[model samples]
Target: MKLNKYTWIFVGLIAAVYLGILIWVRLTNPVYLQKNMYQTWENSYVMHPKSDQSFVNTSKNNDHQNPVALSESQGYGMLITVRAAQKGWANQKDFDRFVNYWLAHRDYVGDQRQTETYLMSWRQYYNRHHQWVNDINSATDGDVYIAMALALAAKQWPKDATYYRSLAKNLSDDILSYEYNPQTGALTVGDWVTRDSKYWQLMRTSDVMPDIFMTLAKLTGDSRWRTVNNTMLDRLVDLSRLHHTGLVPDFAWITRDAAKPVKPNAISTKYDGDYSANACRVPMMLATSNNPKARKVLKKMLRFFSHQQYITAGYSLSGKRLVKYQSASFSAPIFFAVSHHRGEGYDNLFDSQKYIFSKPLTHKNYYDATLTVMAALEGLN
Candidate 1:
């Protein structure tokens, strides 16, 4: 039957709404498992990055440029295993590989860029060093990854009470110099502002301040850190709610106007719409803590990041456009969120989710392994 003009309009509207809901579910669905902690830990650690036994050198011999596998980004994962250990999560072999890799790479020891070689990480943020580093500490995305690993470790095995404290100092010392705008309450990252850097456009995916400060505060007992962190997170929720769109743009621009609160020039990744990298951390943050507000954010995130393809069980190297991300992103965070959400008493994910992650090692595979270990450890619940 031929549709009249009004009928066509009604059908179009319904189709649009239906598509919107489908996308929403795909973006926010949680990857959860109902199992004991030990079982998940075993599954999570079942396949970690294999050591070439050459400290800092996981690359092949044939290449003239022998790139070291260890970097500050690896520290982003220390949270997983530390949480696992605290929960009595043990798969000694997997745990050992995770720790040994850290032990293998010390430049990542504190998460600061020790050399210019790491400008590459800056490249990850958006191809700029000063912007990513942001004048001294100022919350570089690299530092947060390092801080994340250690903070997660604070509650993990061997109980390094000093570990979290030290890492807190390391990350805090540099980032605190940032101009904390009490008005908008944003801890700016880059040297200036632009459409790409309003929120520190250096990254299309990482939220350096919110997760970093919150993690530091949680790991080291600093309320001030949370103040900065929650501001960003709350602001994020507010913006997304206003849009009525579950998707959180990876970047946005924060303006202080002529009032110019300290460093007034900047732009950030909040403009980016792709959910894969930007959305992974939301559920992980939500799952890791018992905070009421965090739970609320997690609920929204659960609705926002439900698209399962981007939230992989592991990285796929089949020449998929996103796979070339070099970040080795995906399933690791889902498992990490699952691991932590299940709490320190569970462990089935280590084995059950093993098949979802990558094996052997591929282009930039170390980071993927690092993320998986963290997710697995955090999945200790």
Candidate 2:
């Protein structure tokens, strides 16, 4: 049917009004902005191969190859899903799918029925037999994040709180039992770390998550969690004293009296001692804590970054930039830290880097993409 000129004009006016309202809501409502960002991130990485399960696949490596999944990524996805669900951007089913994937791929032995530990197997892959398999060991950091997410899920959904809380309690206990060093009060790299292992004394600096530790302590009524939190906080202080810029290493040796950065090629790469990929997360992680020592650590980091023209991908302990490229993983954390702790005169610095989050997420870099959205969600509050 043909419409008259006046009717067409009315239709155009209604469409314009609708578009304007959407733009206004997007610009003025942080929740709407966050939900939009979360949806983009979700659609980019989260995959559902079947009706009941889903996973966040790892992005291509330097070789341009990909893994089926990483437990670390699983933990990241679960935490983000649950947090987004709290904001109504996600739902219980979305969170449950991530949890189901973790359940289906837990650390195990010869038979899938035999549970090796509550901790998740760190990686998943397609075996030569065309069957799916997971690495036998568990990364402590992944376990920590998964446990924290479960605890949070319990609080977020009352009807299923018992189930979530039960899982959280068991995982938390196993983490303390297998991954934590009671004597040193430090978290080991993974479940494979034994006392006799040379790396047993080593702790990934990024594994020092005090806020998560406090949550676990409350969930399980464990004083040791408090001790672990304090021990790592003290280690950060000691490590900070080693450098004027207060940069931390990717890995550190936790001795009886001190925490020291590892030597080059000591753990993973030549940048082990440098503030590289792993250590890049320290700022955002510390930003989550209210502890005075945590705040002190962040202050030192912000001071160093604030003086820099750009926050590059990597840095040296002596405050030298290692890479010219900027990364969301590095910048988002600094942005979150600067925005989180206001009135420190770093507002201008925060403004400078806030554009990083506003830019389109790099789908090839899942770590950066996930962390960027997580930081954005955190900063929204």
Candidate 3:
């Protein structure tokens, strides 16, 4: 059936109005746009487990094929929600749900299910048996972020300061006990890594979050946190100096004298040794630090990123581009990094990517959307 001219005109007007609304939203001020994005992000990803309404589900985004929750996602959710609460968009109730989800999924020791570890299990999934199961291991990245969130919550909501601080201190202690390499002062990937483990010396570049480590140090008064922060910063400087592009790899092996990119397929994937997804967070993480060493590392990276014609998904340490498509995961961090510096060069870089924070939500891109929100929260302020 053919539409009448009136019907065709009506359809055209509807499309035009929708397009106009999209443009208006994209052009709004940064803070307002960020709050909108955060709400959309929360609605799209945050879920409550059917078995336990009190616990939060962090991996309900469309990207995953089955329902699940990752410790990393929980960390992100907790931090994001805590910050959102301070801004009046999120509440203590939801924040408590995230905390409860973590508590209900703590990492265990052995077959008897010894639940001594305060650290959280890395993943929660529904098995084919239709039961929720945890991986029962801890990832340092997730643990660090969880500890940081708790510490922040202690200060942000003083009514519950004592409780949050206690939890933060306990988890921070365990992270030091199990995750830190005492001799090298570098973070191991997880509690599963022991002194004799082959992966003990491997460090993921994005885990070099000096500011968060410093926050943990101040909260717990642990001097060892300073060692972890300084050692990682030194390794980052060394890695940046090794490459003309100043790009850190997804994974690096740290020795007493130097840190080098891991060999391909050494850990998770062939991109493990390149500036891939994991390494893309380096810029935003480094931007959070006040140390001159962090600045030195970011300066080199800014130089490389500022000159890029298009920031793509992956690159080599030697300034070689590996992918053709641009990604918000890469650009948003660069945007945040540029926001920390002052100069005509940096300003232009910031302006070029400011629209990324305002991009309407896309389906099946959980990583990209999450990072974009994180970047916005940090950079827009």
Candidate 4:
């Protein structure tokens, strides 16, 4: 059949439009492209099976095997809402539902006469009996992200700004009161007020998110957060120096000396000062900082990883590979590191992203997926 002139014109127009879109997306900043692709990939993992309001980790790591982590769910909600606002996608309803679920289930400690409301349980476990069991202690990193999300939501939605800001402040206050170590001028890994004294001695380097601290400082007019931020920066450098490889350990031991404000005696013996899962986030956190020192540390770490033929899941402080298997969680953060520095390791960022993008997110691996999202977002920023 002979096509009409109008039909031929329509076909040409459609093809041109499609090609234009493809070129536009490809020509856009790589980080922005990554964010768009990551958002598409993340849609499959963010869902609620039981409560429409709440999201579950649902990755192979947690689905049916363990209870939902309030921290993880809240973190996911915050990330979604913040990204939605940035993209002008308007996701307030879903964000509100998530906030309500956790607010209703907020954890409290102390006796009936003297109770304190801490953050929600860090870990929630679903048993064979089909009940959710809540772990008492809270992870400070989760709390920080939730509070930051609330603050961002307030900024994004002006109509609910007052309510969201108030909630964020309350959460921030709880974090400051319970998690901040005045002696060390750093945030603890968990809630110190509720946990035993022994637990306060150890600090997770990844938990020292400078961006969150700076944001809270600006929002709350509190200099303590800024102080913690500085302390963490200096401590990161010190820890790297201690290891002599610019790689931080998963956990470091904090000892209070009369002469000094806070001293990291050594990497925690129990946690072993290794460049493992928790430590991998050091670069991601540092990449958020505009400080030159942070950049130096990140560049050093990225260069160390660049020498390896293949990035592994874990490593020793002395640049020894601990795990043979490569993981998105490990590689994505390295991508962020290299992207930020544009130094000797800049080429590595693409290699890492290429490896990450090649793998399909079928396993629903919570850590891997979350880090992948974070790496993508950080690189864009």
Who wins the TM-score comparison? Answer: 3
Off by over 4 Å in 4: 1-43, 49-52, 58-67, 88-90, 111-118, 192-196, 256-271, 343-345, 378-381
Query: Which runs of model 1 end up more than 4 angstroms from their true locations?
Result: 1-65, 68-72, 77-139, 151-167, 179-183, 190-205, 208-215, 218-223, 242-245, 255-271, 304-328, 338-364
Q: Higher-lDDT candidate among 1 and 3?
A: 3
TM-score of 1: 0.51
lDDT of each: 0.43, 0.85, 0.84, 0.69
* Candidate that beats the other on lDDT, 2 or 3, i.e. the better one: 2
The sequence of per-residue lDDT tens digits that candidate 2 reaches over residues 1-381 is 356888999999999999778666654577767887789888878887678788887757411234478888999999999989888888999999989988887875333536566789998876788667777888988889999999999999999999999999998888888888877888899977888889989988888888999999999998989988999889988898899999999999987569888999998899999999999889988986989999898899899888888789999999999989988889888888887877887777677777665556677778888888887788866
Model 2, position 299: C-alpha lDDT score: 92
Candidate 4: tens digits of C-alpha lDDT, residues 275-378: 87778888877776777667777777876777778888887788888877888878878787677666454685555555565434544577777777666565
Worst 10 residues of 1 by lDDT: 257-266
Give the winner by TM-score: 2 or 3. Answer: 3
Candidate rank order under TM-score: 3, 2, 4, 1
lDDT of 2 at 56: 83
Deviation of model 1 at 93, angstroms: 16
Query: Per-residue lDDT tens digits of candidate 1, residues 150-199?
Result: 55555453455475557455555434433244455555543222234334
lDDT of 3 by residue, 1-381 (tens): 356888999999999999888767665666787788888888777777634333334444563446678788888888998888888888778788888888888897545857578888998878898777888789989899889899889878899999999999999999998888987888999988888889989999999998999998899999999999999999988899887888999999997658999999999899999999899999889886889999888888888887876678899999898889888988889888887785836676787777675458655577788888887777777
